[model samples]
Target: MKSVAHVYPWDIIGDPGAVQRILDLGVDAVALAASYHTVRAATPLHPEHRLVDARHAALYVPVREQAWGGRRLTPAEPSWVDGPDSYGQARDALKAAGLPVYAWTVLTHSSRLGDLAPEVVVRNAFGDRYPYALCTAQPEVVEYALTLVREIVEQGQPDGVVLEACGPLGFFHGGHHEKTEGGDWGKVRQALLSICFCTACAARCTEAGIEVDTLRAQVRNAVDAGEPDSVESALGAELASALAAVRTSVVAQLRALLVGEVRELAPQARVIVHASADPWATGPFATAAPELGVEVDAVVAMCWPGPEASIPGIEALRKLAPGTRIAGYVLALPPKPIEAAAMRAELAALAAAGVQEFHLYHAGLASGARLAVVREALDSLGQRP
Candidate 1:
């Protein structure tokens, strides 16, 4: 189906006018980033506006701590988000939307720097705090990460689930190992890595006779101290494989745990991966993803570099998961606001890509006039009958 996936704008989520507001535009499915619970979370631009109390069909959830927060999402505390009641409301709202709400969780990213819960923190070579990626290698972490997903499935039984990353959600490979998919040290030093130097991970590696410490040191020296060849000849394949294994297993467990639950509840549920779609994308992820609930339906990749980026991205998606739906997560669409000439150009390029669904990244920062512009954009996208 030809639909526009607009990012749930902050305006819509936080306002009473949200429902009909986007309807005024013509877009159907919205990714609605942020705004996971009973209300919408405030953004820097609109601080006073607490999350609006609304009924939505599709909702996005954040399960980690980056700019979003600094803790694991749970039925209590920071993770509870508005309250566990919010989870139920979230699902109900999505049902109202006649859409499914997927928990866009980041499994590996843990925010606490040091001495955090063993199940949550990712370690470094120096035994420092690279507390980002949860050591999926550990059974505890696998069980822990699925806490919210299980809740969502059992309690909310929403529609489907999407992913932010196989690991964390920030500049993914932005700075440390930005171009390259990250190694143990790169991950650990970024203070956001998901390696587990804990006895558990080492033990597993040792059983395989893999010198966990030596490999860890190689990664650590390269990442922590900026050692050259830190990445070069640094056994990226092995490290990547290990990390991927951790992530894969974590997802696999999640699938093992949730798949049945989902099928029992919403038999036709879809599992989408929210990850980057790149060509030179290095690291163990490509090989490792299938380990997680392997039956992923689609991936949501954004259009930051514009339409040209979409071309390669779509190509990458085809390679990664053929027949998997590609939700082109675009930003800055007009009508509901967030528009620009650059966006227009990028959109033109995306139209050229083999995109089936155009998922606008969000719905926010809009006025009636802007929403009007969004309507125009949609009509332009698919000659609205």
Candidate 2:
């Protein structure tokens, strides 16, 4: 199995030794964050780099023009952009080190864009807008994402592209020190709340013969009542099934568009999607359905440890997309604790379960000891390359 590491561009800029540090980890490829949402962070190497800390920000590489031949996506100079040319610099450095660079592109989770264009953001059944989650139902958002893919490929020139949040992100964001209390917001309720009711989504449902109004009311009632019934069952089984299928189709259509665009723009670069094991694609990827038959080089299953872990996801994707490769995204920090033995075990398990590549999460955020643990694990397992 190929071993890969995920790194933020700032991680490379903040530390002079970042490239060598990652190379020492024995990873074959580096999945660099190309487009990202707002974030606050403190870099281990460059403590002075105070661009994204305590404040949510999007890490966007400035492009000269939009790939779709539309108006340039100029984000007010400082709203969404982080550093100019950082992606190119970091990518070149990694490639020079003989490490393959895959642009780890985050597609929809962007508070910056959502804030700039509230109309394009996802709205719940109650018309409550989620400023952090950009709705894919919006053509403007889709255009922006296509432009991002083209620019990242044309500018950064990555060997591959790892698409994350390629669809609508769910409501449960990892806000700092989050705290909430209420009746059990189980999977069913969360799923109900996750259904997008934006103008475009409603139109799509209507086109698919779904009663948009009735579906919205049912979802609102389900959330308000805090009940745990299958979202489809509550919405009437046939209608629910149709609506769910509609959502899946919506995502599949978008994925196909973007994938086709990538092929046309950068046919040489491999496409890898971070997707759920669930065929419906309802967890993190509320709209994305890899099973929609979009051709990807690999499907990534985020198999971080726990109840919602990746082993099941790997198993599912292995069955669903048997022809494509399965890459396991593993956590290398706290809770998982960057330990050699643990890392080795996880790597071995994923490989045994049909994972062809292991993408280590955040080499930039990990401590030196953690990186060392990764190196030891990779070395001991002989997973180099």
Candidate 3:
């Protein structure tokens, strides 16, 4: 509780005036999905105004995949500035009133719904493009991403740039499958869904002389037109080598991109990442250290609570970037007393584990007076509780 109270965006449906009340309760900031990411709706804005209510919110900007406004399409250039002069303009306007603003960007998550981006999107071994992804393996993809972040930084001038969850999509065989809220990413084996097997990804692996097809074949399960799918016939030999190559290359690239920027602009801004788990875990998350040039002071881990509540990741975070402080993520969506308790527990555990920063996913915790609980937590931090 010795740090600032960080939180999410308040999506006020009917009465917009209630936001101030929410912020009054120690909800130091708001992270919002600024605009929908769609082929048609290039830049995200509320339609009425492109600028988010920055004066009242701490921004965790929700970046869209290629397409956001229903249609799916990936622009050669990132479409974040169609509405405002720059994302930083919104940040600056908000900071005028003493707010902290960071460019909150997502990583390895390019699937929208039906079909948005195909080639430039996240694809499974099956080839069906998920809604939002830009293939992490493609050099072109990295270039586009860097260009956009640089634009936001050079023009927007945010307090810091946050890279959230950077890692390869799960691994797969000859290719991969996609997963949805529904189930399996078709043709692309069930194992391939969360995993990726894009040709570009394979090529990246091949450069290291790994067998791309062998890795792809390894994840393929035997599927009987009449019987349930089984992994018995699926999976190939010599696949791990290929999978390792893809994962390694992707992580290295992300780490380099993020840290490189921080080094270039450390005095003007910071380049950081938010990895609580999965993408940020060890092996898969080998990029957290300064070797990759990550901004240690600004890099933070959203150490949230799990059913079992392990701290290996947090400890790893501390070890990965010795000086970076972690902000344990407090889930506040429903705003229930139980959730508050969980947040409290997470904070307690993380702090005890030596984490100093705390970031609460704003939307979950800032509803009505439920945010009052957050205030209680922050008051304790400020020597008030």
Worst 10-residue lDDT window for candidate 1 reads: 279-288
- Write model 2 residue lDDT over 7-109, tens digit each, in one string: 8777776566888888888888899887776666546655455344425544446656434345533332224234677777778788888999998887787
Clashing pairs in 2: 38-56, 38-57, 39-57, 40-53, 41-52, 41-53, 303-310
User: Once superposed on the true structure, which residue ranges of model 3 sit more than 4 Å away at CA?
Assistant: 1-23, 27-90, 107-117, 168-192, 222-242, 276-293, 302-307, 335-342, 363-365, 383-385
- Residue 214 error for model 2, in Å? 1.0
Off by over 4 Å in 2: 46-59, 65-83, 174-177, 181-183, 227-229, 279-292, 306-308
lDDT tens digits by residue: candidate 1, 1-385: 3444433334433345455555555564444333222223333233346344433222233333332244333322233235424444434554475644554444444443112554444455667534344455556555544554554555445456554434322224322224544444343344323344666667767766577767776665556455334232444666655644553443445445544544556667666655443311222132224422355666655555466645775666656666667666665433223454445455557766766656554545444445555566676666243
How high is the CA lDDT of each candidate model?
0.47, 0.73, 0.46
> Considering every candidate listed, which one attains the maximal lDDT?
2
lDDT of residue 274 for candidate 2: 80
Winner on TM-score between 1 and 2 is 2
Name the better of 1 and 2 by lDDT.
2
Superior by lDDT: candidate 2 or candidate 3: 2
Cα displacement (Å) at residue 227, model 2: 4.1
Please report the TM-score between candidate 1 and the true structure. 0.67
